[model samples]
Target: MKILIAEDDLASRKYLDKILSQYGECDLTVNGMEAVEAFLMAWDVGDPYDLICLDIMMPKVDGMRALQAIRDLEKQKGVAEADQTKIIMITALHDTEYVRNSFQKGCEAYAAKPVNTEKLIEVMRQLGLQV
Candidate 1:
């Protein structure tokens, strides 16, 4: 499975890559805009990520906007929205409203900053993807 990771933090991106590498192929993007661009580009070439891990606070195009854009594409292109192609939102903020909004917007799961590896593993298991 190909996993796409969108995070502005270099260290965090690398950490995610390292953790997921043992599982399958990994793609990296610095910010949400880049993430969407990369996803679309890959899809256009007959490749799509099996999962996307996104950071809410990013330099260009935040996670919310990026998610909206991707949803639009999924609709426009008539692609199925499946839990198999999961989306995990990551943020440091403990804002209940934002978390609620994200879940409503169809994010599979949300993780607080300084992620708990075990919890992340559980989330992946729930998504039917394991590392």
Candidate 2:
């Protein structure tokens, strides 16, 4: 399971990397633009990520837009819905609007800041990832 973690905060980024590395190889990005670039590069090289943990707010591009771009790219590349990478939107926000928008943008799961390892793992299992 190759995972991409897109987070702007240094501590959050390191925390996620530490937690998620147990499951698979993790590629980290500091912002949404880098995340999208990494995603596209991986796809081009035939090494697409299995999961993407995207932060809602980041520099350059926001997570919502990034998610849309990623989904659109998958569609344009003819990748079926079932084959598309699993995405989990991670944010510090407690706003319901953000949650609603995340689902509407195709995220499989949503994790709040100060993520719980157990719940995250459970969510991964629910997504069919052998974590």
Candidate 3:
């Protein structure tokens, strides 16, 4: 599986990388804009990511905006909803509003910060991604 991990905090980024690396190839991005750019480039090259783990807060675009952009791009490219890439929002924020917005914006799952590896893997499995 191809995965994209977008995170700003170095510790969280490395931690997620360690956990996710066992599952597939991971491309890391430190900001939302870069994440979007990578996503677009991958799609253009017919190498679209199967999963994207985005931090809700980041420099530049921010995860919510990035998620929306990714979904829009998929729609523009005629990717059916069932076939669109899976997105998992990762953040320290546990506010009900953030959770609701994440879902509304097309996040497949949400992982609270200090990510739980087991829970994340379970979510990946739920999404039909080989974990």
| lDDT of predicted model 3 | 0.95
- Candidate with better TM-score, 1 vs 2: 2
Note the Cα lDDT for every prediction shown.
0.84, 0.96, 0.95
lDDT of 2 by residue, 1-131 (tens): 99999999999999999999999999999888999999999999999999999999999999999999999999999999999999999999999999999999899999999999999999999999979
Clashing pairs in 1: none
For model 1, the stretches where C-alpha displacement exceeds 4 angstroms are none
- Residue 93 CA error for candidate 3 (Å)? 0.7
The parts of candidate 2 lying over 4 Å away from their true place are: none
Query: Which residue runs does candidate 3 get wrong by more than 4 Å?
Result: none
Q: Poorest 10 consecutive residues of model 1 by lDDT?
A: 76-85
TM-score of each: 0.93, 0.98, 0.98
lDDT of 3 by residue, 11-123 (tens): 99999899999999999999999999999999989899999999999999999999999999998989999999999999999799999999998999999988888889999
lDDT of candidate 1 vs native? 0.84
Winner by lDDT = 2
Q: Write the per-residue lDDT of candidate 1 for residues 1-131, one digit (tens) a residue.
A: 88899999988888888888777899999888998898899779988777889899999799877777776776777787763357899988899998998887778999998888889888898888865
